[model samples]
Target: MSEKVANTFDGRLIFLMLSILLNVFFNALTVSTNMGSAVWTASAVNLAHLFNLSLGNTLFLEGVIVAIVNLILLGQFDYFRLFRNLIFIVPYSYLLAWFKQLFFAMGIPFLPIGWRFVLDLVGLTGVAVAVSLYQRANVVLHPNDDLPFILRFRFLHGSPCWSQWDSNIPPIAIIVVTAILTHQLFAVNIGTILNFVMQGYIIGWADQHIFPQLHHHLDFKSTLH
Candidate 1:
C-alpha cells in the first residue's frame, strides 16, 4: 500500500470560479444599500467617486495594481500568469457592475434602518463566506485577495492573534486607511466599519474549520498522472 498525498493542483478551480460570481453578487448587494461596503470596495468606490469613474473602473484599475504587485512579489514576470490575471480580473470588475445594475433594476427596495443593517450583514456574509471557500481551495487566488493572503503568511505567523487576523496587517491597514479617506469624503458608513471589524474573524473561522477539510479533500492524488 502507498500513502496518499495531496495534489499540488487540486481540481477546485471550479470553486474559485463560483466564488467570483458570489463575490460580485455580494458586492452588488452591499453597494446598492447606500450603507457602504467592504473596506476594499469602500476604497475602490471612493476612488471612483473621486475620479468620477464607475466602481467597475476603479476595480479594474485596482486589479491591475494587484497583478503587478503579484508579479513583483514573485520576482519575475510570467506571461501566462499575467494573462490569467488580466483575462479574469478585468472582466470581473465589469461583472460586478453588471450585477449591481441587475440588482438595481430588480429593485433592492427601501428598507427601514434596522433592515438596512441586516441587509448589510447579509451582503458581508456572502462575501466573507465566498472568500473562505475559495481560499480553502488554496489554488489560484484572486488579485483582490492575493496580496493580503501572501503578506499574512509571510510575516504574521505563530502569533496568538494570528487566527483572528489570519491576514492581519495588510487588510487591517487597508481598511483603516481607506476608512479614513472614504469617511473624510463622507463616502463611508457603519457598513464599512462592521466589515472591517468582522472580516478577519470570519476568514479565520473559515480557515480553522473549512479550509482544512477542503484542503484534505482536494489533496487527493493528482488525476492527471
Candidate 2:
C-alpha cells in the first residue's frame, strides 16, 4: 500500500495497537529469558528494590518523569501529551503482566541459557521493529519511547542510533546509582549490553526494510494541540 494509505488515521491506529502488543510481548519474552530487560525497565526494577516500592508504581513514576522531560524537550507544556503519555501505561502494564504470564505457562523460564539468549535476540529485534512502526505512525507512544522519537527527528538529524543512545543516558545513570546503593545488580547481562548497543541499529534497519512504504509523519505541533 501507499505511505499515505498506511499512515491514515485508521492505519495508524492499527499500527499503534499492533506495536503495543509487540512491545509488551517481546519485552515480556526478554524478561522471561532472564538475560536482561530493557534499560529503562531494568532501572525501574532496581529502583523498586532500592526504595521498597512496587515495580508498577516505580514504572509509573518513571513515566511521569519522562513525560515532563518530553515537555521540556519540546520547549512547551502540553497537558494532553503529558496525560496521554501517562495514561498509556495503565493498559500497557496490564498487557505486560498478561504476556509475562503467558510466557511463564510456555515454560520460557526453563529454557537452556543458550536458547534463552536466542529468545532475547528475537525479543530485542521485535522491540526494535515495533518501535520503528509506532514511532513512524506518530499516533501515541509511551513517553519513554517518545523521547527517542523526538530526538531522532528533531535533534539527532534522524539518527535512530544516536537518539536511542541519548535517551538511554538517564536510565543508565539510574542503574549505576542504584547499583552503588544496593551493592548488587539485577536484570543486566550480556543481553542488556547487546540491547544497549544494538537496538538503534536494529530500529534503523527496520525503518528501511521492515515497512519501507511507511515513513515518519512526525507532527509535533499537532501533538501539542
Q: Which structure among the candidates has the greatest TM-score?
A: 2
- Show where candidate 2 strays beyond 4 Å: 220-225
Please provide, for model 1 over 1-225, each residue's C-alpha lDDT reduced to its tens digit, 9 standing for 90 to 100: 111232234346666677778888887788777676876676677677656788788888878887788778767886665675677676579988888788668667366667767777898878877777665554555676655554555455522234334433444465466547656532257877777678767766665765344542222234335
The number of clashing residue pairs in each candidate reads 0, 0
True lDDT of residue 73, candidate 1: 72
Deviation from truth (RMSD, Å), model 2: 2.1
lDDT of 1 at 153: 53
User: All models: lDDT?
Assistant: 0.65, 0.83
1-225 in candidate 2: lDDT tens per residue? Answer: 677677677777788788889988898788778788888877877898899986667777888889899999999998877876877777666677678778989999899999999998899889889899888877778888999988888898989999999999999999999999999887777878888899999998998998777777777345334
Q: Candidate 2 — what's its lDDT?
A: 0.83
